[model samples]
Target: MNTSEYGKVAAHTLKLRVEGMDCGACALKIESALKRLPGVSDINVNFGTEMLALNHDAGRTSRQVIEDKIRNLGYTPRPAAAEIAIPIDTGRQEDRPWWQTRKSRLVLITAALLAVAFGVAWVAPSLSFYAYVAAALVGLVPIARRALAGAMSGTPFSIETLMSVAAAGAITIGAAEEAAVVIFLFAVGELLENVAAGRARAGIKALIGLVPRVAQIEQDGEIRQVPVEQLRVGDVAVVRPGDRVPSDGEIIEGLSELDEAPVTGESVPLSKTVGALVYAGSINGNGTLRISITKTAADNTIARIIHLVENAQASKAPTARFIDNFAAYYTPASMAAAVLIIVVPPLIFGADWETWIYRGLATLLIACPCALVISTPAAIASGLAAGARRVLLVKGGAALETLGKITAVAFDKTGTLTVGKPEVTDVAAIEGDEDDMLAKAAAVEQGSSHPLGLAIIAAARSRGLAIPQTFGGASAVPGKAVVARLRDGFVSVGSPRHASELNLLPDTLSDQVQKLEGEGKTVVIVATKDLALGLLALRDEPRPDAAAGIRDLKALGLQTIMLTGDNRRTGQAIANVLGLDVRAELLPDAKLDAIAQLKAHGPVAMVGDGINDAPALAASSVGIAMGGGTDVALETADAALLSNRVGGVAELVVLARATLSNIRQNIVIALGLKAIFLMTTLLGISSLWMAILADTGATVLVTANALRLLRVRPTTAASPGESA
Candidate 1:
């Protein structure tokens, strides 16, 4: 549960799924109404997600009070639980017929009445005025009711209020037919906007629908279906071919190709054998497998992703916050200007009251800030969803906005640029054969879990060498060696430095160690108390896509550098391969200093495995954790790469910049259309219907433009002569 502290008082968070919010203005209206309550604070109403989250002092105000306030504001408030439930229909609501929904039904009814009024006018001209009046009144009733509700709930300048005023003013000036037409056009515009909004929300809805409602669990030696919520950690869940994995777990039985496109956005299906990890919401291919559940349904990967994206959408970007503040004052100011337009011309210039009043009504209709209010959040939500679809999880709009401004990227070496697992690369004989030396080393490190130890054991196994079966008394020396008794003598596997201290390293072997270390290989000595056996060389190689990922960042004109605790030779060797600069032998504090120095130039983004690089990640402008990293890393960083690809860093940048561009385009479209309509309304060149069209058309265009971000495919190419 999300909680907050209000001074010394603990405040409980309330998350509600708000329905009937037609535009961004409705979110603001609900927020305004809730803020007037006694103990509510930290109010956030996301129109894109239709979620209302707030903190309230439970001692002063209960959930019921907050919900009642939302109801009074003319919106239905339900607990957020309904939002996470898997819907029976995975398809989008917009796919259904437009007239099937309640909002669209109202629009259709208004249209039908308007057509009847027009038919009456053509057939009986004498009763045409009354017929038009009747049609206008029928539509005006609902709009006026909502307008009155908004005014009573603290939002006196809502879009509904403006529409109601415009419709009534037109009828007052004896233009009942035009009033009817304006009302009908407003309904049509709203219906179109609803469809567009539904389209924007379709991605999130699809994500919720990815997991099935029930999972097949094995109980008492019998397989039965159970609700996904009943799945517990360690329970065995059977997944057949073409079924979605019910929970995050490891495969304990069978092999199959799992399609993780819905969760991680990987295009290729991954082959999952025994002991392989699988996430919930992944579609299984032609195999039946039993998996040991590692995470509950509530804590599964899909649930976390959905939660993160919703919270991200709720967090406003810097631009969105600015626009919100601007709209707050802009609305009242526009209303005052409209009032002046209505009174000044008739009172001072002896102009016709009816004509001036008509112009004032048009101005009111044009003054709606719906398009401007939705501009930033709509693009941000789409950008987040798009990134999620690609497995680039940005935490919030601020982080997404900051990613675009990053001029330099700093990466931790181990587990980030490199594969993080060391492998035996070379073996040399100083006394006995190389195979004998490797087998002796493996005998000493048989039970060890160290990367270098595991590599030697694996190398010996791969070569089918026979390790001594009588080896015993194996013990580890911290940061140095693993010593064990083999056949009547003691054999040791340790670093070159440790061998030198024990006087067991031969001069030839010492020189060989230097050569291997210079090439970025870790040289370990395999020797006895009196004689040198041989040496084993191990190295953690760079990831396959490391070079290409670095090249992509350079192409985007950003500096790239590696910070590592490894020796200069090894760090530089990896850096040389990846085509990036290196800052070697840095302790944790030194890494922080390096990040600070990088930040002196511009905003620096730090990428790390998340556990050892927390300080640097926190110090940088935006920290991006590589996927499969520790939970601390994922939570500490502003964004995470669930795909675990180094190339995802470049893609994330491209997506952020694309989102910013989309936002700018939306703002221009929104304000530009409003400016044009505002001028035309004042000049008497635009009618009331056209003013409503301007508002509605701008909203639809902005929303549609924001949805284009969902289709963005980021590609990488390196330009010539770019460097860190």
Candidate 2:
């Protein structure tokens, strides 16, 4: 989250939970005020998350000085909890009911005074003026105080300033009743805005609630309850049926079905066995599990996810930055227009002074920019929360916006397009029995770690063959073969080229090797110094969903290409089945070059799952790593798919497009309403209270619309060739 580094000087970052920021304008006010202080180099305030993060020189400034400055701006600040820990209590008053909040109490008091004024007006007409004045004063006091604080904090044209000026102007024009009504309506509007903002922040709270308070640790062969924070790596924990897993760990005892819906949004309960990895917050179904903790409480999967989402707000979208810049000048421009309307009509056009002043007050209320400033961040926060729920870990708004603009997708072939594990598909014998050839090959590959070697041994075991026990002196030849001493002669199990170099491959056996290689299978020759034994053909097939997932990407009008280090014939065979283009036999640097060329046409996204693929993943516009891949891939990629499904690529694109559309809708609603009310107020058809209603209604509507992104479901393209 640090924007830059200071040479030879240590800098510190301060994070605070800023309360009472009802709209984006309030966040801007805090940021503008803090920027004037010495040692404050960078500041980021997210209105949707109500989190203020800044970097400063620790030698020049302290946390108390910065917090005091925020208090002077008329907002409360509390120290934020650690980014990777579950947020239990952060000294926030958000848990209180609406009626107990400061704004709600003030609104209730103002409403009571207004009701008393109405009753007094019916009893004595002469005393009605004083009664209305009392009601207006009660509501105007808080508004005037906040307006003064904002003005001193470097924001003179805030919404509170406009509201105070309009209410005071109404009272000066002898419309005390209308002035009281306007003040009361504005208070109600502020209360409603507070409530709506809470709903938008509910997603973060839900994630924090997923972790349980207590964990059952197995110490000295007995189970005892302990706080989750006390859990550490290498500790063993017991998870009973119907209970949530306390932390991220690996199962070592019992098998169970785990419901991962709350954590990963996966609908079906996954069946897990011994040695399987389980995440925190997954529910154990119908069986107890003893798991060895792999990650501590702070480093668990759920904790990391929360940390990612909270930091995502620091990376703003281009559109949101544009709106922030535009709003800086917008408020002053509106204030100037109101002054012109009040002065020009009465001074030059011979209009009545009282009526023109009244219309000017209404225009001031109509020009408040609350709705316009909040349109972008709200939608972006909701979109990010939605993506997190589905386990599509997009880093920030910049990445999410860029994902919507991708024109093509490039996939790594080995583990991305096909199952990474190879299986023995066929075995042929030329000079000996097939069983004897497989047994010799398995003997040489007994403890080998290669995929093809393991597959050959597994085939021998499946057929119940008896491998020779006298084989010894086994060793591997890098990228060629495995050689071993079998009884009296030496035997080698390797690629056909290795066998040919030793003059052990015959023409008839060579033909079989070419035939199997042509069919997208790898052929390993089993031979001796005298003659060739046979060959074992192993293949890593495409995943069951690979074809359908590729079709979906194509349907969305994105070009799909496969990049792999496999042979040309093998890569092309898989590409043909999935209906995509292929670039085979690519090394790490070659993959990087291919990504650069693809970027020339448009933005490209690369999907890969190995350490060698790191260069190409970083070279592309957006790098997406599979969940089961190496840690290097996950760390280098901009985004990740936790479900390990190929179809998630299309889902990510669809979600990005949907979020962009939602943002556009919010902007239209915010601006269109203001345009309509501005025209009516100038024509003397709208009153002061009506203008306030329009502004308040627009802010509430825009926020509610943005929260709709939380309910968005995964969608596919409607038809083939549809533009994304």
> Model 1: which ten-residue window has the lowest total lDDT?
715-724
TM per candidate: 0.90, 0.90
Cα deviation of 68 in candidate 1 (Å)? 4.5
- Total clashes for model 2: 0
After superposing all C-alphas onto the true structure, candidate 1 shows an RMSD in angstroms of 4.0
lDDT (Cα, 0-100) at 303 in candidate 2 = 80
Question: Could you give candidate 1's per-residue lDDT for residues 247-348 as a string of tens digits?
Answer: 889999999999998876677998989999998899999999999999888878888877778788888899988999999899889899999999999999
What TM value does model 2 have? 0.90
- Cα lDDT computed for each candidate against the true fold: 0.85, 0.83
lDDT of 2 by residue, 1-724 (tens): 3344555656688888887776777788898888877898679887767788888876687778888888877688887765447865544656677778777887999999999999999999899988998899888988898888788878898888999999989988988899899888888888888888888778778877888889999999799999888898999999999999989999999989999877665678999989999988889998999999998878787887777787775577888889888888888998899999999998999999998899888888888888888888777888888878777778788778878899999999988888888989888988778998899888888888878888888899999998775455588788898889877578889889999998988899888888888889888888887788888899898877788888888988899999998899999988988899999999888898999999999989898764457788889998888764223433558887776778878888887887788788888988888888888888888888888877788888888888888887664555312221
Query: For model 1, what is the C-alpha lDDT against the true structure?
Result: 0.85
Candidate 2 off by > 4 Å: 1-13, 55-62, 261-274, 427-440, 458-470, 473-480, 483-492, 497-512, 526-535, 628-634, 718-724
